[model samples]
Target: MIHIVFNEADIPVLQQAISLDESLQGEVVVIRDDYAVGPLDHTYAGEGREARLNWWREVLAGGDYEGKTDTGEVDDFKTVAELVGTLRRNPEETIWIWAAQNKHDVSGYYWLLHFMKEFQGRVFILYLNNLPFLSEKGQLFYPIWLHSIPPKEFLKAKKLARPITLSEFEVDPDEWIRLCQEKKLVRILEGGKKLSQHDADFYDIDLAKFITVDWQKASKIINQFQHKNKHTTGDAFLLWRLKKLISDGGFDTQGEIRNMKDFEIKLKSQHQAETA
Candidate 1:
């Protein structure tokens, strides 16, 4: 089954699309995690549960409401696992779509992550309003309340069952830089040329007089400039530099990164650059 993961920036729109497509109508289910209980039902209290029931009434009408929302408040890890297994083995087409409504609502991932491991079904993620560091491409499961990792990245990283670093997913660092450069936002480097993906990381990147070696050096430069110079400070620069430095796409618990497309892209792009 094919799954398309999207950010929660467009939930109402997504709900509309899911509603319109007969094939997709009943196939998709949304899961939400609870956060700080507000003066109202923000914390998924009895009222929050009832509120959620009402919200889904309009959203999931004509489809099964189930009248049940699984909050981590209860310990039902095994039940969740079983549900995932059943969904995956179901002959009917289906999509388990999760909406991380708030930044602190990351507890939802615990169960979903467990489910995905056992169930071989399509899974998609959506991150609604999130905090900084947790908004990396729509995932908010980082250390700072589930740091902002991309939803797909978070899913893959969870499957790997390890802490994620930038290098874990970024195979084509130079290619990524090129994409940034094409956008003409790469200025932290003088003549920053591409390098093999292995060279980009938090440490062990030798410039050797090249413009910019990899993301590792770029972050050091940015942080140094801010710490030592104090002349440059901005979210844009930090993000750009961080994105550049953290493109290593390193290994997993198996001690290997086997995604060929990411590595292959670098060589293919480099060859094209050389020929052109």
Candidate 2:
């Protein structure tokens, strides 16, 4: 059996789970790209893939991930092709896809399911949607990410695995394709497999609320936003949006914007206060 997960941080936790239960042992494969954001039209094809990568490049430019968006590093297409090849070569082999309740994992599941239609019965899913687990402190909590679950708890999570149904194979892929056609810049998990789409600047206004006349590090503002916001996005994307806010003269900045720590931002009103 092969284990597939969407988040990189979950890899070690899953490995620990496998260690506790030898019955669950398998090689873990991580799908690196976050499908919850950016373009998804024809992503399975070369032209569309390049277009998405180019978009990432634009987002990452002058930020922390600049020049780190190499195709080889973030190639989910290649990873899927290899997994498909493995399944074809060994018919007896099966796969287990693990996903948490968050949009990141669900969106990944949607994107990945499109490619696994042929191996319907062989593909299994363990979705931890609305499921409660015991944390290290022995407190009951519903985790949004798999890594938050203790290794011992995963032994229980493994029991939730079930083969991808024939109905799901037909229906889920259509759902993913529909999302691709919608071409929305953001996808938010409403509940279960349901996702709602929004425009690119959806978070811009809320993000602005965190800004003040008092200067703060770019990282500090992003940290506060993530802590307070119900729907959280990646810091790189938020930082990119911050640059956009700055460019639009909505905010004032000091220092280079190459990285979060390299710059500080404040409300444009601060400039008026200084002049007065």
Candidate 3:
């Protein structure tokens, strides 16, 4: 079962996700951030954060629901946990929600939860940045956790670590290497259209270039080639390399994977995490 959470802006995206999950029977919850915590009715005296937190705690104790938190404004998480618990007796089956702040990126909110310990490790995060219902176009990005892994709310690194892999469906590694070796600026083998490696190359370099660049152009070409050729470009071999990297503690170059490793160790020592 999938629990969906969303604000007004996320209505369309959330609706789409629900529609796609037609086979998965589940519940959908909505939180009007503008009116949460009895904002207009005036539930608590100082009932802003404190009231919200209290609501969450009560919800957590209730343990009835599972779904996304709508902007984490009201006792959203608490309520979500309550329901998620009913569906998931074993912690493994549980799903929790934490709504994120809009704009820029999720890093800020990610750190906020991490440092504040806002999560209890039982729920998952469904990012709503991409939701068209969002005032900001809500593009429907996938779920994201910071460097924080499962089952805890703690910050890892300012620059979070995430996994990335090249899909070899179009261009094989050998072909890419060969193109690079040949110094070819343009190659168009797949993707239903030809691509120019570079009709032009940028001379100026910026800080974001190195960090954000995925070399997608190169990877996609190879993936496309593989598809057109009706052949597999060795996903099994790549998975092996990925395993080795995880073992070696590969992560963002920000040097923060160490903290993630530390938290992982601590969690392991305290209780045996099923996935560990």
Best by lDDT: 2
On TM-score, the candidate that comes out on top is 2
Backbone clashes under 3 angstroms, per model = 16, 0, 31
Per-residue C-alpha lDDT of model 3 across residues 114-203, encoded as one tens digit per residue = 211222343345443322221124343333221112111112111132211132212333333333334332232232112223211111
RMSD of 3: 24.1
Error of 2 at 246 (Å): 0.8
Off by over 4 Å in 3: 23-25, 34-78, 84-92, 96-122, 128-276
Candidate 1 segments exceeding 4 Å error: 1-15, 27-82, 91-94, 126-276
Cα lDDT of model 1 by residue, 1-276, tens digit: 222222233244444544554434443233432211111223224664456445433322222222233333332334444455656677554434343333223333322443353333344434332323334445444322222343333434322222222342243333433332232211221111221111122122322111232322333444455454412323222333333433443211121112211121111234444664
lDDT of each: 0.32, 0.91, 0.30
Ten contiguous residues minimizing lDDT sum, candidate 3: 199-208
Q: Tell me the lDDT of candidate 3.
A: 0.30
- Write model 2 residue lDDT over 1-276, tens digit each, in one string: 999999889999999999999899889999999999999898788887888999999999999888878747888988999999999999999999999999999999999998898898999999999999999999999999999999999999999999999999989888888998898889999999999999888788888889998999999999999999888898888999888888887678899987999999998785575774
Query: Model 3: how far is 105 from its true place, Å?
Result: 10
Ranking by lDDT: 2, 1, 3
For every model shown, what is its TM-score relative to the native structure? 0.25, 0.96, 0.25
